[model samples]
Target: MDDLFAPSDVSWTPVSPKLAAVRRVNAAIIFGVLAIVALIALGMSLGWTYGVLGLLVVAGGFAWAWVLIGRNQRSWKYAEREDELLVSHGIMFRQLVVVPYGRMQFVDVAAGPLERAFGIATVELHTATPATDAKIPGLHPDEASRLRDRLSALGQAQAWGL
Candidate 1:
């Protein structure tokens, strides 16, 4: 039987670990909001009992979210083949998207404020149809640009309509 858990023949390139930093930043924001809410509720005479319990639950959830985010970042990967590019992610659901070079219309590299601050970028692949487009996130800026250019060149050279 084929190995169900093993990766395929194509060698996948894993995303930058710096993505965890972005996720941590987002988790920090959520915890901050929760803290403010708890403070407001306590200040409004909502009783220290409920306020403290709510804070504890929210704190636990925040910790769990960090674990999930770390797993997700570790799972995210992409590979380029002779005919197509593959993007795969998800710790449980296992999503894999294949964007044929021939169907690719363009590729873009983008970084948001947090991503830029972390020196990482995301590459978006646009196929002839919106349904086939995909994104690979958390790559170093230089790698993202290189991937964007390579995909663009390959797409132009081998473009075949969907």
Candidate 2:
């Protein structure tokens, strides 16, 4: 089963560990706000009992999601092969996507505000078939730029019309 998802020959490059930290922080911020709102709203309208319960429930949800986010981050990996790029991720239901350079139409690099603050970016490869397109996130900005250029060059070299 492990072999099924493992890269063929090239080594797998795991996303930066900082990815987990960033995601956890995002989760914490969202959950924290929800907890605060729940505490205030429930306390004001439904009494302190429900307020306390709501806070507890939200806290538990954050804890659960925090662990899963770490696991999911650890699962993300990518590898560049001679002809294709391989991206694999997910914990419960794993997925592996292979995008051939010849079939690539273009490449894009994107970084959200939080991602930019964290100095990380995502590289996405577009193909004629949307199903074969793939994105690798949590890469350093420099790495993402390098990948985008490399993929664009490769795609042009191996150009296969739509």
lDDT of 1: 0.85
Among these predicted structures, which one has the highest TM-score?
2
Instruction: Please write out the lDDT profile of model 1 over residues 1-162, one tens digit for every residue.
Output: 222332478898999999988988989898979977986687467777778877887888889988988998998988889988988888788777888898887788889999999999999999778988999999998899899999998898887443
Off by over 4 Å in 1: 1-7, 42-45, 160-162
Error of 2 at 84 (Å): 0.4
Candidate 2 — which pairs collide?
Answer: none
Best candidate according to lDDT: 2
Error of 1 at 145 (Å): 0.6
How does each model score on TM-score?
Answer: 0.91, 0.94
Worst 10 residues of 2 by lDDT: 153-162
What is the per-residue lDDT of model 2 for residues 46-95, given as tens digits with 9 covering 90 to 100?
99999999999999999999999999999999999988889999989999
Q: Give the TM-score of candidate 1.
A: 0.91
